[model samples]
Target: MRARYGCVCFAVPKKLIQHLADRSGDEGHKQMLQAQITQSAAMRGTRASKTVAGVATNAGAKPLQRSVFDAAGQTFLPGKLLRDEDDPAGRDKDANEAYDNLGIALQFFSSVMGRNSVDNKGMRVDASVHYGFHFANAMWTGEQMVVGDGDGRAVKNLSGSLGILAHEFCHGVSQHLVPGGLGVVQVAGMPPALKGEAGALNESFSDVFASMIKQWHAGQDVKAADWLLGEDIFTPREGRAVRSLKEPGNTKLTWREDDQIRDYRQYKATDDAHRGSGIPNYAFYTAAAELEGKSWETLGQVWLKGFDQLRARSTFLDAAHATLNVAATLHGKGSGTHNAVKAGWKKVNVLA
Candidate 1:
């Protein structure tokens, strides 16, 4: 029987208790137990019982929406996928495009490196499309990756290129790869924002991996790698390409104003321009380029290993150190891999 407050039914007769008390001299213990029962009853009498959100309802549960595609795996909220207006053939928005890109990204990770999934633990990948009306950007929101069909002028298709998807999915990979993992509570010694940098590294790694996939697929020399994410995704509305790997500020776009079309050229800066990624984006490209040959085969492995081994809230320096350690451990202290990683950071003034 359930206790009323702290009172439990004593099935034993009072004569049985008297016999036990005489044998054990436990009268004080019995009295204490009786007192506890009385106090518990007092507390319970003051308590209230009520139903909340129905007995079996989970109305407050945070649901995760998941979707799997050929290029990558993504989870996202409802009403995310949007149409791509920039397709010259007007076929980019086809759902199959998302499926195809997801396939490519997943295959690149598994087939290229012999890895299973982003976390290597097989966490479900999530993707969302048509985020926000005519949104101009795509992002991996830590939980799921979301893509936007650009304004038909700046960015045309969401799934036309594998690198773009890879970049976003890499965020998931990085979240799992970090030491403490994502959404961890802040410890006394660590800064919360530093933990967020793992997301950035995730994006950076995706770009690196995407470029590697392109090079591997094309069978191109590392030096000759195009490093461009979407070569054909941009429309004449934006005179320039989606983003340039070799040059940051030099991509030009053409916009129409008052029925008169004018070509505007821009370089990436701190301002809100896609071109601004040129600085750090190029740093990653430069690092990989400096370590030529099959990137996933060597340089990519180094970065992956480093990212996986470091803490969740790593800095650029932490990444540099991890890369250096991996290089020295795998190659040697002064090997070309070591020197190249060092030089790559030096070029960006990120390291000595």
Candidate 2:
């Protein structure tokens, strides 16, 4: 059997697709856009089934290896190696953005968390930009990151957004660090009963780290940070973000109807990973707010340590326990850090 890993996508949601479809002036154009979205969705599903090939694993002592490829609006993997680590920035804005953001993400893992690279062993980071014509999505394909330039009407080029790039890259990190690779469905060894919860954790970890990296890059403290994911990519009128950690269910800023849930009691077992991730995302935000410092300082370390300790089939309750234990270990048994972790989980009903 082939070793399988999760594919993380930053795709425009179905709701937004519907909204865009409604707003499209030409009926034929609307149908075409909808069809394109459908095709992208189908492509994602297919990619999920494919096994990881050619991508190197964490190995040896090497500096950061960054590569940016230009797909030039074609649906192919690693189209042309446009830039490597030795090359200076060129004219393509999308490629430049992808390369620079990859560096930022790589730096965060290396400097803040003391991780060598995405896999903690210097795995090369590679990205492909301008994938497909108005592809309307971006994804980490278990091997490399593929970014799309969205349909000009509804969405913008995804590679231009740092948050989205970081989010996808973090998925690569989670796949390497976590057991069973954080897939949406239960991988071979994961407990069947915990599949949904595992999926939620997969997304929650990505969003949490993504926010942390963005904050770190912006030099924002926990209190000052917006705690939003994909804010740059989404138009303000369309929505503020893909998800908001600070205010989980409040959409006043974003106008997104399906707001995130703050408490575990609000969790829907049937909800997809992105929707279900709100619970843990809010829990992280609450913990960061309670700690009241740079998010990457204490809360980030705790979460990173917790990710290392997470079980293959870990659920929200498991995460709460792991993070709380990590906090105590790192910040003293009954210190404020430990208390903050406990309180944050309690707010989300993960703990009493």
Candidate 3:
């Protein structure tokens, strides 16, 4: 009856959440955060099953048609349909924001990328807001989106952050764009995971595209864009943003606890997907800066299409080569754009 992407991906990393849990002084709040992580991990199996059956699509639906549901502080997904595409804004703030955010994502993909929807088949966007009491994360469940209210202690107002919303939405886009969920792989007994370097590339794609979407929507060029991911997600006392593509692991640009590494040589297999994503994220930022134009105009579609060449276990070097080939194909053998793309990967030590 519905379509599901091939994997489960979240805008917020589990490692970051675990960090918050560890530092939290309130035992009840810490336990609640931990419980949420457990619940989230369990969702992997349920959503992965939906994808295994095949990606059922809405071939007849329009690009902008969507439904935003109100979860009413419960963990169940898409609790109750709050607003349809044609419906007026509702009384609930989070629900309306979720509805609008999804609309923005749909418009960007359709109008700029010339894509119908996440599945490129006009699939209706489904989203839910107010999921879980004081939940501090947002995630794409392969089937739809789930947004949290935030704990107010560290993260607050998740539904209101456009960057964060776009990041999660792009998780859906990456899942559909690259079959087998980019870097995600479904093991025999476990849910599909963003494992190894491929998983980090998967995360990097989301950050790159999410940054593009934000810049495009704001009428910003590469120079004008803030280049901060989830800048509004955390409390000021905790950090500035969740991550920074321009300067990954620069805690001054993000939070004090950020551990993202931009150099491929610095990447460890044990690093969280978000941490490892800094390599590609910085690469894209560098190239876009060198190209000196809007990221969407210069590299967005190429990056999106380039990911289609990815396999289940594709690594950083694999991504670097694939994206460079895509740029060369679209621009020219040694065109300025192609060279810029190469420079990006090379800057991060992903290319020779």
Candidate 4:
């Protein structure tokens, strides 16, 4: 069957790889790392070719239908089923981490957002851990979640991070909810102008929800939250997370550019969707900070509702207008929430 969508993977950034290569004492090891990074860059173009086979779900009102698979460091997916929803935890740490994190993601959507599941129809959540040989990335494969055991030196086992799992899960949520399935427009052979904005929106939405989920799980308020995604995946010595919403340009690694763009004038049209996502991510962060409370409540709700109003080819301005309307509808036009939304967009230069 044709793939449901082409999803983005949370891979180690090129700059990080370059930094690691430069720091390596062994020339042989440096070459290997450089080769790996090059291979990953090439793989992005063929990501859509990877198909995820469908599995039937049991019918019921079960709290969560979760299945975690062990790929056992091989390339094949959904490799031996290690745990199911009813089964007790096994000896495998990766399997257990995957199972627990999937539960957390499901709980966040159901309890906080009042959504049934990723599809809002109680569809089963399936995840595969230990996928590929030191694969160094994680993704939602249109059908299920796949996390790799990262190369120990540069990256860690991705299944261990709750934020990463939540981020990938949110990709599935966006695919099922957003019109034309966000970034999937590019995979469908649409023009670049139509695809870039959708793809950037897709990436930004995932980052926003991922940050929100992490903060909610930690019982952190907006101010207390670190506002970093994939913090757990990177080594502490690296001193940088995958991305930061609070401070875009501030990175632990010196080679990386500031990923956060607070103004439209700073925006660059790049083929890399993740780089282009800084605009919307900063806007969401700005709105949440201005609201100054539990982000998942007001700002999160407004953005969630706003997603439904987004067209297939919606631009950043379209998102700003939709979110403003949502905030005003949720709270009166003159309310704090409405004003915060307006100010957030204006701060990002999306609104005049």
lDDT of 1: 0.49
Show pairs that collide, candidate 4.
Answer: 249-258
Best by lDDT: 3
lDDT for predicted candidate 3 compared with the true structure:
0.82
List clashing residue pairs in candidate 3. Answer: none
Sort every candidate by TM-score, greatest first: 3, 2, 4, 1
Cα RMSD of all models vs. native, in order, equals 23.9, 3.5, 3.1, 3.2
Give the per-residue lDDT of model 4 (tens digit) for 97-135.
Answer: 989988988888899998877888888888889987666
Q: Point to the candidate with the largest TM-score.
A: 3
Better of 1 and 4 by TM-score: 4
lDDT (C-alpha, whole model) for all candidates: 0.49, 0.77, 0.82, 0.76
Question: What are the TM-scores, per candidate, against the unseen true structure?
Answer: 0.60, 0.90, 0.93, 0.89
Q: What tens digits encode model 2's per-residue C-alpha lDDT throughout 1-352?
A: 2225435455455655666677768797588678876775555444433223444434435667788888888877777778877689998999999999989899899989999767777877778999887777787876788898877755788887878888888888887787666644633553221146777888888889989999999999998899887777765556666778888757765445755677788787777677778888888988888889898998899999987888666888989989988998889988999988888889989898
| lDDT per residue (tens digit) for residues 47-94 in model 3 | 532221122245436668777877899876667778877889989998
Candidate 3 residue spans exceeding 4 A from truth: 1-7, 48-59
Give the distance in Å from residue 286's predicted Cα in candidate 2 to where it truly belongs. 0.7
Candidate 1 residue spans exceeding 4 A from truth: 1-93, 179-202, 237-239, 252-280
